[model samples]
Target: MTSFFATRLAVFSTLLLGGLSTAWLQAGENPDPLGEKTGGSTTVYASGKNAFSFPLASLEDEERTRFVIGNSFFKRNWVEAPASTTARDGLGPHFIARACASCHSLDGRGAPPDWSRTLGPEPDATVALLLRLSVPGKPAAHEGVVPEPNYGDQLNNAAIAGVKPEGRVEITSQSIHGRFADGTPYTLQQPHYRIVDLGYGPMAPDVMISPRIAPQLAGVGLLEAITEADIEGNARAQAAAAGPVKGQVNHVWDAFAKAERVGRFGWKANVASLAHQTAGAFNGDMGITSSLFPQEGCTAVQIDCLAAPSGCPAKGKTDKAGKAPEIDDDTFGQVVFYQAALAPVARRQAKDPQVLRGQALFAQAQCIACHRPSYVTGEGPFPSLTSSKLSRQRIWPYTDLLLHDMGPALADGRPDFQANGQQWKTPPLWGVGLIESVNGHQRLLHDGRANGVLEAILWHGGEAKPAQQKVLKMSLAERQALIKFVESL
Candidate 1:
């Protein structure tokens, strides 16, 4: 390693040297013993059922109070304009849910609909998931997928009063069964999506769809706190690797930066900052405009949608003129703060022998090639949304925040900025074990197709194919050990 990387390791080693020891564990050996304490001293100890919405334990009293206030806006549904509720009025010309909490229930992942059981909430009604739409564009477009002209980038399954909804989302599935080295059979469900009930007209001849589930909201602020240098360095390191796991960076539009920047959030890393992601959700998911996204979400073809109430202020400010944006800047900022301040669940069972053995085996299997286990966030511009202690802190989020090709099985066939159909930003594993408790379901992967941790692992391909192969051959005991280590985190 060069001096620059050597210094990085030196700083990382210094920060993580003493909480525990992996000296006796080869594959698990790292000088950073506090790897499982993902947020370092800032980790929170909420149970899985209570996970995802807790504030950082170190926050000042004032910041803690702000978190509570933000929680109300996040959960409460917004209403249509011309109503008594002026502060939160102006619902969709077209939208996916009533509130942020609709998709991110309890600040946790959205559970995949159980086809065998009842159909969950209306797909567009903030049910914790939605489908992204785009048509292939020329290389010169450079902005990733082209939005379907009349419908825009996302398929909205619901609309506000007096406006025609964009379309409906329908899903069907088929199962694929495979066996482990020890002959234990496992089955994986493959989802197929169809867009029906087109309110406007037909989609482009070749519209591409990418379905995404709402992710758990813990530690997102810290994820945004991660520096560009570290993410780029990981990309460079992986490109130079002798293995199959070379990953690429996604350059996405950052509304705040007013330019394309390194993406670090979303399934395809299509978003650069938490603020951008939050504002985009306010507009696209809930049809509630914020200063960041000032216009209604209506497409040109939907005349009625364009006529929906917007809270834009009159030419000059006045009490009669409602908040220009349905959600005022102060409220939006507070929501961002709440999201940022939410603490990552403190790791569980890191000291177990099985988990440690699994940790070692995980390394041996080369899973770390893409699912990078640790990072040191750089000093950043994030203010109230960031904690001072989080600056330069060594964190173990278990992701590289770069896109890796996962082969064909998991490909969405959708281009997102610099990310191709087969590439995906390695999803973080820090809170992987708590999803079941938080959402009451254990669906994994971008579409909630993989049933659990192990199934998710089995579906890996492309750069992760070799890693998956290694996992496929491991003894059932060894595999369980590896999975146990992941669950412990």
Candidate 2:
């Protein structure tokens, strides 16, 4: 018995030694999680003790509940029929997918074609379906070339083929490689797109293409709850704290209100409100009518739009209300409600010793400066988002919701609302870890080029270049710890 006990003790000692050695080795190879190496080492508290929890509170207002239902209506792959068509309700005349959920499954991130296996060899078709934009000249002044009328920025990949394709789009990718400040090398997958088979003949070869991947939808309701004034305040504070890292909100026209407003939706901070966003989607993505966007998208060059079997009916027809026909506003409103109410998932607790250490490193490295960890939302009609509950409430979304210049490496050379080329809204980090499980792909960033989250960070430039430089110098173990913390979010 004594001999056996001694043997067990020896084995335990060997395991402990091995563990330490492994950790030491890891410290040499991983990307820095805190985005840099701070000379002073500090201890991080374990997140298991102070993790954020997801709340499943009810939305009490009748109107708000109805909105939630509408937003979620397309959460599955079903599209509602047009108000006039009772027999066929879901398939669209021109659409990227049958429903919003098809692109943003489970309210999670989207993957690019290069990273998608289910899309098969016909990835170009999917690429054409992706959005594209151009400015027509140098400097891209705000009053420059407007989005192509009728066709807009996106090309409808799926169409009632015989009608008109909003125009065919093509996508191509280029691989780029770079090294961190510490001499660590990384590779990024970047995309280049072109519009082909234009009904109006060829477009200029120099027209800029910007591929967009649909982002996750969780906690958007909370984002919406953040007041415009508060967002502006945060931007001002960040600019003061760090000169080059400053951010700004985009203000644009609100089609719903027929007035200028602060922009919050879209990759380039274009659309101002959920109501306008829904209306735009109905018109551009699905070729459906909505109260805000009342016209059918017709290209002057497409002869078929003037021919028979065209989805639009004869010009002078009167509807039941004795007015021109359009998509029902109430149905569209419901969909917006659903999109604005998705709750954030619970965060992983930071109880583990390694995670605690990593969190401390994260703060010290200045990552929290832009990825602001908490915000208090204003009161709203939705019970779950009311000011009483939102005011001073601690929520960890990890985004400032402002635009920043990301440099030429990530630039698409397209202007959106007031954002110039290379500008993008800081995406929220909540539910990022489950993107693969929910969306079945691991693509990251605006174009879905990054093979992994690490790749995405590595691709950062411009305002985030300093943070990227810091990350390159971290020990492998420290980098792993940082990734672990992000996963916990």
TM-score list, all predictions? 0.90, 0.77
Q: Where does candidate 1 stray beyond 4 Å?
A: 1-34, 116-126, 139-142, 312-323, 385-387
> For residues 277-365, could you state the per-residue lDDT of candidate 2 as single tens digits?
77777666555555576555555555554341323322444456554323455556567666665556555543555555555556545
Stretches of candidate 2 exceeding 4 Å from the true structure: 1-56, 60-68, 76-92, 115-129, 137-145, 179-184, 306-326, 381-393
Task: Tell me how candidate 1 scores on lDDT.
Answer: 0.78
For candidate 2, report its TM-score.
Answer: 0.77
lDDT of 1 by residue, 310-370 (tens): 7534233233334466777788888988888888887888766676667767767878777
Q: List the residue pairs that clash in candidate 1.
A: 96-124, 97-126, 102-126, 103-128, 358-481
Q: State in Å the error of residue 331, model 2.
A: 1.4
TM-score of 1: 0.90
